[model samples]
Target: GTLVEEVKGRRFAVSGSGFWQVHPASATTLVDAVLAGADVRPGDRVLDLYAGAGLFSAFLAEACAPGELVSVEGNRRASADAGENLADRPNAAVVHAPVERALRRGALGARADVVVLDPPRTGAKEAVAAIAALEPRRIVYVACDPAALARDLATFGRLGYGLESLRGFALFPMTHHVECVAVLARA
Candidate 1:
């Protein structure tokens, strides 16, 4: 697969074997998630936790025109790829670190408006706490496992973030796997 694609008038640069192993949510799913829960707009500052090759970061940058779009990843390869993918976007900042450390280091200050978390099957508990402390206007969570999503949702509730909306995408046509996106707002 190619590293670049023009989807709906926006250019997305993806790295990592240039393969389709990680199928980012389809165009429809992306649009639906944003429409359902994102409270982003021009000039908002955003954070993409567990950013892979910067897929969501690129989309957020295009949609929100955020003052800053920070992409954080711990894997060296993924971090390098994310940096490459977002290199052209002046508003995008790629941080090579674990999500918990990045958030704890005050990478997300008190002024961020939007935060996106697309963690692995094992969700991010510490990172979630950091995000809650920031009190962003909105938080978008993407998860591949329902159990993890539920657990994280419970954590969010304890931290005063209400579940605003949720949408699921069948990225895998016939498997038991499902991808979910949830929007959360400060309660």
Candidate 2:
């Protein structure tokens, strides 16, 4: 089964039981947040980590057309869907690998102008250093856990990436769960 979500006029094909924003408004909200925070320019090389089903990859690829976009995901099913979802964009490459390994291996590229990090609840502790090593000018991180986000931010701070801004969304109305988008810039 598949579920298709339309965000800001763009349609994304998501696998059933795969990760998709649970809140009805979350997909749109997060997409808007990420695009604004990224501030990607035309031909700016970009990387989308943990790019489930090519959600952000599609938009990023369009923004960076003729530049490059490497969307890396560890989930086999999700990566397959991402390949299909991003098929229309020749500038985007969907890689089925762990984000950490991809970054560590320099498989994606040597550098990126903008990087979008949407790691799981555990945060991207394992990949933070590797990502920073890419020396991206900006990083937009979408985090679902505050503690993990804080820890990763601290790690990023040590890696010369400073938090430029942050926005929080209460997607889960009655629950403690909240989604946060933090923008970081190289310092």
Candidate 3:
């Protein structure tokens, strides 16, 4: 089954039990945060790693018209949904592979102007070096775990990426869970 969610006037098709943000307001909040931090320019190449059902990729694709937006996801169902969700955008493509493997195999291309990633609670420790290797101008990281985010941020720092700005959101309400969107830039 497919579930279509409308966020900030954009429709996203999520298939099966794919990873859609748990919070009702999460999609819009994260999209706004990422777009502001990305500062994407026209014709700029963008990469959306760990993309789930093309949530952020759809918006980025519009912002970087005539450029390219490569969305990579490990989950089979989610990737399929992403492809369908972004079908209207000719400049957008969805790759079904783990973020680490895709980056290692150069599946995303040689360079990216901006990179937006929403890794799981464990974060993207394994893909930090490879992502930094792309030398993107800006990296917008959406993290669900503070500990994992800190560890990954430290790794990014050593790779010449400095934390430019970070915003935290209490999307979980009563729970202690907090979502943090951190933007990093090559130094």
TM-score of each: 0.86, 0.97, 0.97
Candidate 3: C-alpha lDDT: 0.92
Error of 2 at 127 (Å): 0.6
Alpha carbon deviation, residue 74, candidate 3 (Å): 0.6
Cα deviation of 173, candidate 2, in Å: 0.6
Candidate 3 lDDT by residue in tens digits, 1-187: 8787899987888875877778788889889999999999999999999998998999999999999999999999989999999999999999999999999998888889999999999999889999898899999999999999999999999999999998999998899988999999999
Better of 1 and 3 by TM-score: 3
**Minimal lDDT window, size 10, model 1:** 16-25
> Across residues 104-135, which tens digit of lDDT does each residue of candidate 2 receive?
88898888899999999999998999889889
**lDDT of the candidates, in the order given:** 0.78, 0.92, 0.92
State residue 80's C-alpha deviation in candidate 3, in Å.
Answer: 0.4
User: Which portions of model 2 miss their true places by more than 4 Å?
Assistant: none
TM-score (C-alpha, index-matched) for candidate 1: 0.86
Per-residue lDDT tens digits for candidate 1, residues 21-49, read 34554754664575457667889888888
